[model samples]
Target chain A: MKVTLIAGSNREQASSTQLTRYMARLLEEQGFEAEVFSLYEHQLPLYGPGEAYGHEEVLKLSQAVKSAQAVVLTTPEYHSSISGVLKNALDFLNSEYFEGKPVLSASSAGGTVGVSSLGTLQGIVRNLHGLNCPEWISIGSDQRKFTDEGEPADQATELRIRKAVDTFVHLIHRMYG
Target chain B: MKVTLIAGSNREQASSTQLTRYMARLLEEQGFEAEVFSLYEHQLPLYGPGEAYGHEEVLKLSQAVKSAQAVVLTTPEYHSSISGVLKNALDFLNSEYFEGKPVLSASSAGGTVGVSSLGTLQGIVRNLHGLNCPEWISIGSDQRKFTDEGEPADQATELRIRKAVDTFVHLIHRMYG
Candidate 1:
């Protein structure tokens, strides 16, 4: 199965994106193909509510979500909520793009716990009518920094991510396997 | 005192903008100069973190927020949260612009109640370190429509808005008087 992973940060060197890349490696090692969508690389215009400027990036983004059997989103908790870049990307997409798909959410939190933004992210999933896996990954502020290959250096953090990956993949099996 | 009002919607005919304009009238009638920041009229690029491409619109948006004695934000709840356009505009700003300023938030709701988004918006104000007035406004889907001159047709809705305006203006007086 193929999964579309969104690295939902706008910073040039975002730990959230790095975490997404790490998760991509974990998913790939499990024999699933993973595509990482980075906002820094694939920029989008500010969305007009009803107007479609027909931007190329938006088309690619929509196509990625449309074709994926499942989707993953990684974000950094900014000011107790999800980053605006991620929120904007979600704005450009419609319910049909994510409908019935198994979507997983993760966070590289700035604070002690990233649960603040997760609730809002789940709300976004419900808004898109996507089936969001209950188990989500949250790398606290101190645990977010990763190596060059996007591997977490801390063992416990790595274990949490691995278990999250397993839970998500198992859920995907029930839906699409 | 000057109050900066943000019409936090991008729709061509957004009632949130209308509500903002209406509040402007109310603020003006009570002897406060009001300016409304609108996404539909003055657009901004998607924000890139730590990058100062220095768009003229961003400068103006920053200046408006920086100079206001008080600020009011009117957002339409999209997906049970604030609109992406509003969030993007806010992303371009920092706490220095809004610190200690009086910020009152309101919503043009898609669903029955907009409290769902207000809590998050208050979180945003807190992030900016602004003194958000405890009273907020929410126009339900039914009462969101307004006249071209920015007047609400519903009497009870108008009264509620007027009361919110009074509460906000009262708070502003306590802060700046």
Candidate 2:
């Protein structure tokens, strides 16, 4: 099973990136092939008709989202919501792209609201007809959640991630099969 | 008086951009120095810690936003909210960046709900400490509502634009002066 993790954190050392990486690893450990597409690496133009008219990068991005079997999005909570880059990427995509897709939306940030943006995003994805996973894994601003090496630091968070991954994998199994 | 219009529409010929340009011209006609910062021209990385550490481009963007006396943001509604690129640019800004600045949020989109995203964006900007003009402008999607040159075609829409600009300028005068 191919699982695409869309990492929305715009930093090299972002907690959101670390969280997405951890999710990818957990999914891989469950015998699923997972790849993360970091928003930082993509040359996304401000999404609009300009880019919609065959911008090579936007085309590649749309194809990536379309081809994914199961999609996982990790975004930071910015001003009580998800970052704009993640939102921009999503804006360029149509509901047809996510129709029947079991998408998992997760968020992490510096404060206590690890998943504050999740509620807003969940509403959006639901509007797009995406089958969002019931349990959203939000890693609240637990500064000690990540190790010095930027890995998940706490055992409890790690275990929680494991359960989220299993739930995601099971959903993919039920939907795609 | 200075009114800097940040055209958030990424499209080469978008109704929102047209409205923004029209608003800028109208402001200039009213004896205010108006400038339009097309999002398509600005090269900002997605907000990240890398930029937070004073990346060159990030510094330039920060300075641009800080120097503006008042800002008019024109965005297209996407999935019942503002576009991601605009949101990303806002995310990159510090809270104090718009702390005491007057802002006018407007939208032009295809759906009847195109203006719906403006309220959400208003909430975000308010959270960021911006003084938003409560009387917002929204153009419902109609190809005929746009001119051959992409300016607003309807007389009523033009009247509305004038009223919005008048309100925005008044708000800036009242708040800043």
Tens-digit lDDT string for candidate 1 (A30-142): 88999999999998888886555488999889888888989998898998889999999999887888766777889888776787787678668756757656467888867
Worst 10 residues of 2 chain B by lDDT: B141-150
Best by lDDT: 1
Maximum-TM-score candidate: 1
What TM-score, to 2 decimal places, does chain A of model 1 have?
Answer: 0.95
lDDT of each model, Cα atoms only? 0.82, 0.74
* Docking quality tier of model 1: incorrect
lDDT for position B22 in model 1: 91
DockQ of each: 0.01, 0.01
Candidate 2 scores a chain A TM-score of: 0.91
Q: Score residue A143 of candidate 1 by CA lDDT.
A: 87
The runs of at least 3 residues in candidate 1 whose Cα sits more than 4 Å from the true structure, single-residue gaps closed, are A1-177, B49-53
